[model samples]
Target chain A: MHVPTPHTPLPRRPFDRSSFVLSATLAILAVLTIYGFTTFDTNGVDMDMALDMLGDNAKTLFFAPGLSNVTIEGLLKNLGVTVALGFLTTVLGAVIGMVFALASALNLAPVWLSVVVKAFTAVVRAIPTVLWVLIFAVSAGLGSVAAVLGMTFHSAGYLIKAYAESFEEVDAGSIEALKASGADWWQVVGQVFIPSSRAALMSWTFLRFEINFSTAIAMGAAAGAGGIGFDMFMASGFYLNLREMGAFTYAILIFAVLLEYVATKLHTKTMQG
Target chain B: MTILHVDNVRKTYGGNSYALDGVSFSVEKGEFVAIIGPSGAGKSTLLRCVNRLIFVTSGEVSVNGIAVTGLSNPSLRRLRRTIGMIFQHYNLVNRLTVLENVLHGRLGYKSTIAGTCGFYTASEKNRAYEILHAVGLHEHIYKRCDQLSGGQKQRVGIARALIQDPTLMLCDEPIASLDPSAAKIVMDTLRDINTRLGITVVANLHQVHVARDYATRIIGVNNGRVIYDGLPKDLTIDIIQKIYGSEAHDLILADGDTHGTH
Candidate 1:
């Protein structure tokens, strides 16, 4: 390998505590990743099955019997359910999170309260989303209601943390100026926080929507939420129909891509506006 | 009538040292008082305390003879509506239009729900535009603040303050961040507002010559206390030397040519 000329001395920078934490975290992750690779498991080798599914099975997966019926009815209905789950949960999370977000902002509310809220959300976020879904399933029994509530609960954690952080980014002077003008808390929030961080907050909400969408698909399959993902689960597991799985998978990919594209466009528009 | 009566006002930040140590001064209605000080001489802190932007540790700050120290938030807010303040950095919300920023001055007058819903009365909007026109920013009222030059931004700041229809205006280093010509324009606008509307004006200024030209009275501050307070003509070289110390030499160097041209 050709070695490039030794680089010149770079200007020194003061790495903050966060930077040090990030570096330490990355280093630990690298070590864990290397150890995992070394101890790699391919014990239950289904290499032939995987290869056969991707290659020979590709034709049957796409062109199996009842493909037309699956496309019109099965695909549309499940896709609708999956999309609704993502949409409703995200909207609910965003609205609920927004109320708590204001109370959670250090600038807006008391410091102890903000810190308590922030810590509580961090703990909620720490629990895995799948585990959250399963936990809800026990109480509510396996259904779409359980899935929606579970996903919303998890999403509230994400939105609250992100929204409060976004609120914090509003100029300190802006808040002070408003408060000095004799405007109360709600007026101050309406006039300053909403306007100052409008684009940023919108972008964050959209990002949360994107995340919840993917999680919703997973919930549909994992917890019997009756969406495209559940149909996908049935196609892959119970039916033994490879083509149905392929169709469902493609349907999901298309939907995800479209949603992402729309989000990007919307984010850009809001930021510029 | 004395519009401001700050009696032995002492303010300390979180640290033990006083930002304003037993500082006391009073301003009459329609008088332009220039607070001249060196950097970090607690000029900003003093002005902020006057408007109750920051709480005073243990002293009295009475605006229009109303004690500000013990007033509840609602009462303090009502008191603040009559006292307009502009900043060195022109604290206009950058994303909002010049018109929107100016309208913020009228927020204190509106009901909580009305302001929250941004339902400004039609007259309030008209008054905002009139103030913008007074500050020479009416043409650019639709433009967002971030798009404006520093001078234009200060114009928006002035308009925002003016739209409050204030009895007293507290300006903290209003010309500190502007170029010479822009500073001159902002100073002229402030002087006009003081003259035409008879609003009591107290501005912290760096350029001693500008203070001499615009301010009816000059108050020199150093080390968290007032060292001098008198008419601009009565502000002696000895007091300037005492207030600025060695830094007065640099002020002379910067002042002569700029002061002569205007």
Candidate 2:
């Protein structure tokens, strides 16, 4: 005699705190945006003239694209410089971040040391990368030095958090097994944690490299670090040449796509290995 | 000769509740002992205290005649190398090869730089191969641990522990997650290690019948205290009732023995 039990359903509440909060936040932002648009934003906007000029600029930027101020070789050389900047800062950040990450990982380091390292990295990460660059400009005199220092500092802060979390997420059971086998702290990290978290670490490092690449481009114009971004700045702002701006934009877009393809391939290979 | 001793071991969580309340036991060398209890009965805690993986709140634990409580960190690690531990989860590194994971057992004997560089000598590699062969995992030596089946993974775990050349082996629910057939193989392998290598084995087991079938001695626990400690044949229905309390009714022992009717 097999009998199925009757199902009794519980009453559902109409109110959900999380959804209500989200809706309320979006409503407030909508109201504030509407108020700003209606009140103070139209004084100097010149809607009709602005729309006409925007249409013209878009046409010239997209349809008639050719570099007049710089040769293809010069543009490529400048692009290489930007890439080198990104690579240098990424390597420096990875090395320095790894040390702090080890000190900050909960399972590996003392509680106090982990807390101190995490807090310091948190503060550094809170600051915008560009702001860090500007701050370093005061000391390093607005050249490649300032850009490299600022970018490395910010990248280290970002990667320290990423690397520490990956290390912390390594299976605790594996760590316990190693410890039971009499592995010391360094040995446990080397044998178990590093090997286990290698894929995550590599992915995070590549993600940071991508970020540093874009930052390097921005710093080229903003901090006088010579790269394609300096030439683009000249084409768009100083020279006001929309065609040259379009050409530079296309070059950057192609390179960005290639970088993504490479990163994806490397990630897949490492995961399989 | 006694190989492991737990003297009045007490473990408390958050200053109030006792996980293990003044538990005491001793095991002779080459004995296969299974500590059996329902979940939350301090079976795992007692096993951890033997190796000082988790410290005992009070009382002393001695392994091979050395007190485990007051040792410094380096000395504790030095003492740990002689002991091997296996977990219910088969805690081999999933991304690493079986050979690499087995060689991890030798990490305690190497310098930090050598270990970091993964400089295992040829003899160590040969020993790892032999252990893998013994565990029937030689065909999967180059396979990542994640690719192995549950039984194969547990065999890899056993091989890793054996490569330590340990005097005593501690297992925490070594088969709680396995299927019945896989569980049988793991238990059989553990019993073989006990008999063949003469390594003392202490395991926490949840299944009463499995414990009785494999272990030479059974120690039953309930509510943080040992209730029954004797030969498996001596664990009658009444003693099992005392050890398991109200839950004893659901248990069916091997050879058609159920609670209260035997």
What shift in Å separates residue B131 of candidate 2 from its native position after superposition? 1.0
lDDT digits (tens) for residues B1-262 of candidate 2: 9999989999998768899998999999999999987778999989988878899899999999989999998889888988999999999899999999999889888888888767899999999999999988889999999999988888888898898889999999988888778888899999999999999999998778878888999999998999998999998989888887877767744323322211
Q: Which portions of model 2 show Cα errors greater than 4 Å?
A: A1-12, A31-49, B253-262
Clashing pairs in 1: A61-A243
Docking class of 1: medium
In terms of docking quality, model 2 is medium
Q: lDDT at A29 for candidate 2?
A: 100
Q: What is the lDDT of residue A196 in candidate 2?
A: 95
Model 2 gets an lDDT of: 0.90
Question: Distance from true position, residue B221, model 2, in Å?
Answer: 1.7
Listed models, DockQ each: 0.71, 0.74
- Which candidate ranks first by DockQ, i.e. highest? 2
Q: How does model 2 score by TM-score?
A: 0.94
lDDT by residue (A180-254, candidate 2, tens digit) is 888888888888989999999999999999999999999999998879888888997899999999988888889
